[model samples]
Target: MAARAGIASSSTTLSPRVAQGGSNIRGEQRGKKRKSPCLSMPLFRSPLSRMLVSPRIQLPGIRLRSPLVGHRKSPYAERRMLHIDLNMEVEEENADAEERGLDSGIDQVHQENAQNCFDADDDVPVALEDEETGVDPGQENIQPWFDPFFDSDVDDVVPVPQENTRKNVVPDNDKRRAIFDAMLVKARKGYLKGHESKEVSAQFSVPVRTVQRIWKKGKSCLDQGIPVDVESGRSRCGRKKMVVDVSRLEDSSILSRTTIQDVATQLGVSTSKVYRMKKEGAIKRVSSSFDPHLTDQNKIDRLRWCLEMLDPRSVPHNPVFKPLFDYIFIDEKWFNITRKTVRYYVAPTAARCIRTIQNKNFIPKIMILTALARPRFDSDGNCTFDGKIGCFPFVTHTAAKRSSVNRPAGTIEMKPIESITKEVIRNVMIEKVLPAVRAKWPREDAGKPIYIQQDNARPHIAPDDRMFCEAAKQDGFNIKLVCQPANSPDLNVLDLGFFNSIQSIQYKSASTTTEELVAAVDRAFEDYPVRRSNKIFLSLHACMREIIEVLGGNSYDLPHIKKGVLERQGLLPLQLRCNAKSVNAAILSLRTMADT
Candidate 1:
């Protein structure tokens, strides 16, 4: 009581003479505080603590004892007692938790707490917790009761902050369409409502002028009875096309065009600017590669090879390439156990995967010999023969002679035949390729001859190699090996498109060992659809047609017939029909060369 009296008396400057109902002790305390010049606030001066501690005894410092403040001197005087109504908001962040039977509090989730310290005068929230432990000092957001009237300055109106949007940006098609649709909603027969353009410009992040232009374009289209299309010609309105004198770059060496920087340097511009040229097709990216140099005899031989594949029955008119159902294409390709660059889609929180290999230059790779024949389709397009003879890996199983970290001694392991030789190819053909052919060959054509077409690679054995002849004779199968023309990979079905298709599927799975690599390739080979195999056969026939046209040159682009759409419509041809004149000319040219 004494501390409260001293605190209330020290505030004499805040009291008025109309409330001079004070005792003599109050006068003495007020005089003492003035003379001492060391008046400190009472320990219980906090209104909240005082309210809690002295609930029955009203404190004048907190609430006026009289109806009006300064009308009394004693802290407890109640003559015409005025109650100072405090504008406070009590917020409990525990309603949701309480309903769910969970406790919630300011800094913990296990307990509930209610805080009542939102001050209307200062527009600040006060936390009751003593000592700050990195708590966020609450914001002074004005409460709803006082926000509109609580103007710190009477004359000035506060401006609400908005996001910064760049001016004069041409709106995209979707935004323009939206703006036009909004205008159309309120449009009175094509003219936008008076303030519609401005309103729309504010709604979307677009300029009023741009919005008006879109509205005008839409109205113009609407007047013509066309669908309202306000699509801006943004693609055409951009920076003018870059004029590249391709002739000027003609003399540039390969080194100069190897990189964008080199080309940009020669053209005297930043490398960044060259990408625009690339995008605009003013500059193009081309790969520097080596293709086999063709000789006149090689060309003649390729021409003859195409002439031989033609069906003699259709030689006179509407010549169709022979159905290559009995022809099996065989090729050996080296598949990497895992590529140097493999892509994986992982979650943001997933651990980064680190792939390690023994040696980068010597990444595990194995040679696979794959055999494929034309898939035979019944009248209903149901496949009778899937045409996959087999994919055989040139690997041998041997016991490890020495113990290593990866394996113990005498453990059987699969090791790829690294140095593939003619003998290895010959052995694989007799043991694996020939047997698969005999087993998978259509029963209807059991007595018919089968031919395996191989590239003229060094490792390829002769057509009548002794071991293959012995094995092929045993199955009552007259399977002969024919070599494609030298330097003519387009002549074979596998090289034309089959290998590329299956390899793309093969690369989808990761492989770490030679066995896994072989398994992946075999899986890819079987997973390859027979319908696509038929398309590849047609692609080979298309290549042959191109070869005959260019006099055996492989310079023509692969023709696309939209085979999928055609196949869906049941119009896919069993064999591509060739022009009679083109075939005759090819034959005549070969004869003329033979005479020379």
Candidate 2:
């Protein structure tokens, strides 16, 4: 058959016959050949083959037939394939289960729980067991249990141990006895020990000197081996004599009556001295009518007038003159460049003999000249510039000596006489004085003649100044020069209003150089207020009126007024308002205006 099949297959003549068991046969003998069990039916013939076969591989355990295979079956091979398919299906199912678990977030939850465990272990530094005596001392232990107020509530009722209480103690009775004994000992000590006083007197019940004396006497008693009987000494005391009767000497006896001069002669004293003694507490005045007390309102008025006279702005009509010039005021003081230093005595100790000499800087005295114009009432009764003007010149003469003794001494050096000369005066008048005056009265155009009033100083009517004045007169200027009483700086309103003000302001400042001194003087001048100048004018006018009133309304007598008369009897000197040069410039300008 095989040969026949082979021949047929080769010849391609009849239909080929099939052979089994890996043999190939070709024949169209329908029932002649046997089939191998491994072979299945053709895939095209099966309806389910489409679901089983693909281009790459077939499904596990699925049978597909070749075209040549007929009904073929291998039981063992089928069983083996079935087993492999089942194994692959079981592996795929397990992998699917694992993937579903991951999607449900079970693995992520486990990971976070593991991290929390690690963090909890790291929070505490040490274990509680390690903090106790279980750990060695040298080994580091992080945790410890401590209580701050472990012994706060101990017993107070129990007597404190020796170590718990303070050591020092004092008995009150012993202290009192010791103080008493000290006082007694002090009473026995001599006055020499008492002289050395201390500041402890305020604290002790007894004097500080007594305490010192007690201490000394206690030491002396101890050294001399003497007993101190404190109680017995305190018990002893002394008494003083008392007067019983008192009598007075009677001056009513007619035969014994004597004149004050006769009594003074008998007593070998001056009559005035006798009267002074009688007026004072020393002796009694015999006559009741011998009233030595004189209420000289004129003197008071004169004094008040003098003060008013010092101020150029003050007039007799003003009521403030009595109070304003009652105190010393200095202004417009000038100092020489050379004499700027002042000497003072400094005490090294409280002892008078231990004084140390030193030089302090003080502003030197300067020549201050000023003017006071009387108030001229206008048609409306307002004060105008038509009244008579008074000029006052004050030379602030500082004592060059260490002592500022008011009395004129032969040894005291005076300021230079030529400092108030025509040249200096003219320069100041033009440069500084005129500008200030013009600034003060810019609106006033007084038709009255201009007058320059001054004291009887040589500079007041200097020959050179007189020649200058003549020259000015030739130019048709109505300049009149008036002289104040000799040595009468107090009468000059300029002396008080302008010059005194300057001196007081610059008194404390010491300028070593001429420029510095001049600057100081200028500063002082600037410090004065314009109202002060007005006050000075008022004061001067008031003084003039007072003087006129004192003279029974005739006129003010300049000659009779003393040069050194105080502006107010016990009051301060009047301060000048502006500089001398300013006053002079005002006068000159007024003169020029009058001439015009």
Candidate 3:
């Protein structure tokens, strides 16, 4: 069968050979019978038989599949194959790949070589090679491939050209260099070193280290007689010293022992100026010398007693006695009451008799009523006075005595010179005195009995006056009569300050009659200044303090009349009990005098 098949394959070629188809083969000539068209083809035949008998097989009419697949070769293919071979050899030589024993394929090798070649030529423009025709590397005038498009003569499609204008470029490098140079110059002049290098760094826009390096390198030259740049010299005003004035300090020394603080305060200067003055020996200090003993008990007591004599109810007892001693020490000139001058005029001897118009000095008599703890101001007492013709105790002897004949006939002679009588005393005590006393000491002495101080005179301790006293005791008031010292006026601060003031004013405007005198006195009393009242009160307070001190800081049991007299003088005692008739009469006298 094999021989047959080979002969059949040979015969198919012989037919083509006879007709110039020698290249072609015939199936029948080779002893391979041609099958009828009606016969079914055999399945799974031998390889040679199939090749010989396959009618579909064409001869010499076949074409190459692709250029790369064909047996015919080109320079490009040969070169590519050579490169692939070279890459295979290289991959085989690689120790790492060889150790793994990986046998790479020719196609894979070719692919890798192609990838590496592309990578190598990535930056070179593809058009550059096309343009290079045959240019040598040294040829500079070889136009690039796209030059034809740019040429004016060629019908080239050129894009419109844009104008090239210069743009703003920052001079960063030059500025940095200038800053460095400035710092270097500063360092060379010795104006920057250590701390100064840091300052220069801040000022010149350079690093501290750079400034420091320049400083150290230039410092030796700077020290060795190289003068500093004038630009880097210390500011003239910076090193100038401050000067202080010493003349101001000398002026302060004129003040006596004044401290710098005091001088500063006085002159409206700063304390620092004063301190500077002290340092310059311009001022000295002085100590104070004030006596502390001037405010002793005796003086304080006297002052207090004087104050209390104004208002006995409120005054302390210790000071009440102090007024006595203080009064004794007072200058006699303070006690003497000067009589008012009388301008006497002789009337024409026609009205009744050869008459002198009696130009009398009017002094209103203050009827003081007082009570004491005992009947010591009675006739039996040591402090007695001739009430008829002499001044009574606690009464001022400023009025003159008159003869009986001179007294107005038929008129109630209730004059100041009248002698004391029981009826007269009773009338005065009940009508004038008691009421005035009550007005001052409004609250009757309920617990401890109060005394009425007076001189030993008929009017003071008379029978009627005694009876009146008894009647006062019955009416919830413990009344007593006291005997005052003879001729003692100093004990009364009120009399010295207040009453004296009233009398002085009244006497200056003398009156011719008793009515006129009363009116003048009343007007004068009313016109007493508020300041005088205040002074009188103050004096009484002083006297009370004195009395308190004398009594060892205890209470005073002094006569009520003494207290009343003080109150009246000070204008303090507002409560007084007097007969309405007497008060009315006094008021009438004042009114009448005022009218005249």
Candidate 4:
């Protein structure tokens, strides 16, 4: 009865499980007599702790044990039971306090501790006491430990720094820029099917923010049956132009401002603005070379020359032009050993090429006399004759006078002719020029007299030079020497572009000696494409029209006729049609002057 009193009095001291109607013993074991209710009750047992029971019933993830069997209860056992009951009462009171604290929503320290205990499974431990020792269980009222975080004043934590890396992205292809935008829209609609932004971005190799923007733009596009398009920006929304009245720059009075910077300063605009104007064809870049100061006699001579070039059969109506294929252009040019400046591409680790010369003026140079006629082509466009008569250099081979690093004494060496006199020109025409004309002239044109055109340089032999006239009547051939107006280089095919073309290729092959320079010039001349030479003749004809338009004044830009396109389409004309009005006006102006 005393044990029964002890068990009943301690009913208020029961744990949460017992107070909530939990039992450790099975229902079948409850009918048997025991020392006290506490004996049948589990000692220091928790729902979290493993419960030992008889083999009759087993709970998953739990340890079961049979009730302890004894003949009688001892005083020590009674005292142990009292101690356990007292601890249970203390724990019950603590649990009630914790619940109250939680309800009040204050005591954040305890709340944080409870949160930690809930987060970590092993935070709150359940200890089982030894039935034999009767040792006092550790702390009964376990108030949750205070969290250090609650005592601080900080709201946000500091984050670790991250490195910002930049990638070198190439510019978008201007040709396919529209296609790229459309692809972006289509990919966003197809690949971003309810997935995260990063997933879609990784799949498409685009930024996450870009993917988000694409999705946001594509939201209502599909539903509304409107095409998804990304607007880059409104046109003309960039930096405003600081200078607007650019027409002032077109005044001829502003001709002194030749460079972009000079024009920019005068107009109070950036140099880039001036460059943009140039790119848009608002202005053009031209060489500052002065035109030939023509006299009255020079103008008359130019007009006469143009009239002679015109076919006499052509009139005011049904005008026909001469083919001019039976004519040859001859000119002299100084071929230098090297250019003043040259550009080369080399590896970063390569050794630099050092070109040493004692003096640029003293550098080796040779005078080359080149002759060419209009190339002949068949109806099928196959070249019949290349019309390259030959190029002769004014050089002679002689034995080396003294020993030098370049060559030993008595070694054969090439030397340039320093003095080019009229006699030298006469001899070259007789010996070298006339022979080439006979050897390469087409058989059909060989029967007709061919005109050799040359510029009016003082060193050039006259048309009636005794030696040249004697050489002209040879092997049943008729060749005449004709001199163009002074300072009218544009009239000849060589000065029109052929010399510049040869120089460009000759400079490509670096030469240190006169011999190498001559060889390089010859190779360049030989390799000069025939079609390019043909184009030069057409350019000569174009220049003649320009001269006639300006009344023999050299103040005209070279006309770009898209000759390459014409040649490719087989529509290139053999001769340009001269404007009949210009022709008649020129003839009338000359005749009127003559009549006066």
For each of the candidates, the C-alpha root-mean-square deviation to the true structure, in angstroms, is: 16.1, 41.9, 42.8, 17.3
Which tens-of-lDDT digit does each residue in 510-579 have in candidate 3?
4655445555655665566543444443454443433333432223333234444564575533222223
All candidates' lDDT scores? 0.70, 0.40, 0.38, 0.66
- Backbone clash total for model 4 is 5
- Among all windows of ten consecutive residues in candidate 4, which has the lowest summed lDDT? 54-63
Cα error, residue 158 of model 2, in Å, equals: 33
Model 4 misplacement above 4 A: 1-243, 250-256, 318-320, 347-352
Higher TM-score: candidate 1 or 4?
4
**Candidate that would win on TM-score:** 4
Residue range 1-596, candidate 2, lDDT tens digits: 22211111111221111122222222234444555333432222232322443211121123234446564443222311111132233235335536544223323323433343234656533422212222233333322222111112322223323333443322243443465454454444433333333423333444554455445555576668897422223333566433211122243443443677666545556777766767765765544322113233333433333333333553323323332211112123345544334455767774443323244354333444433343334454344542222222333344555544544444444343334565665554444433433333214432234445555555444423654455434323344554544433545666645665666666657665443555666666555654445456545544444443443121333332322344235332333232334234334444454465
- The reply for model 1, stretches above 4 Å from the true place, is 1-242, 265-277, 280-283, 345-352, 403-407
lDDT of 1 by residue, 1-596 (tens): 43332223212222221222322324442333222211222233233532333212112222224322233243522122222223321122133324433222212311111123354578576443312111122422211111211122423534343346365687789888998898888887656665877898889967888888888888889789988878877678768966656566678888777888788877877787788888978888877556678988898999999888889888868788998988999998888876787777999999988988778899878888889888888998889999999999989999999999989999999998879898888888888888888788877787888888999999899987887777787757787889989998888888778888888898988787777888899999999988988888888888888889887876777788888999999899889888788888888888898788
Using lDDT as the measure, name the better of candidate 3 and candidate 4.
Answer: 4
Query: Model 4, residue 406: what's the lDDT?
Result: 80
On a 0 to 100 scale, what is the lDDT of residue 204 in model 2? 47
Q: Which ranges of candidate 2 are over 4 A from the true structure?
A: 1-447, 462-466, 470-477, 508-510, 545-596
| lDDT (10s digit) by residue, model 4, range 103-144 | 232243234444543446656643322223222334233322
Arrange candidates by lDDT, descending. Answer: 1, 4, 2, 3
**Can you rank all candidates by TM-score, best first?**
4, 1, 2, 3
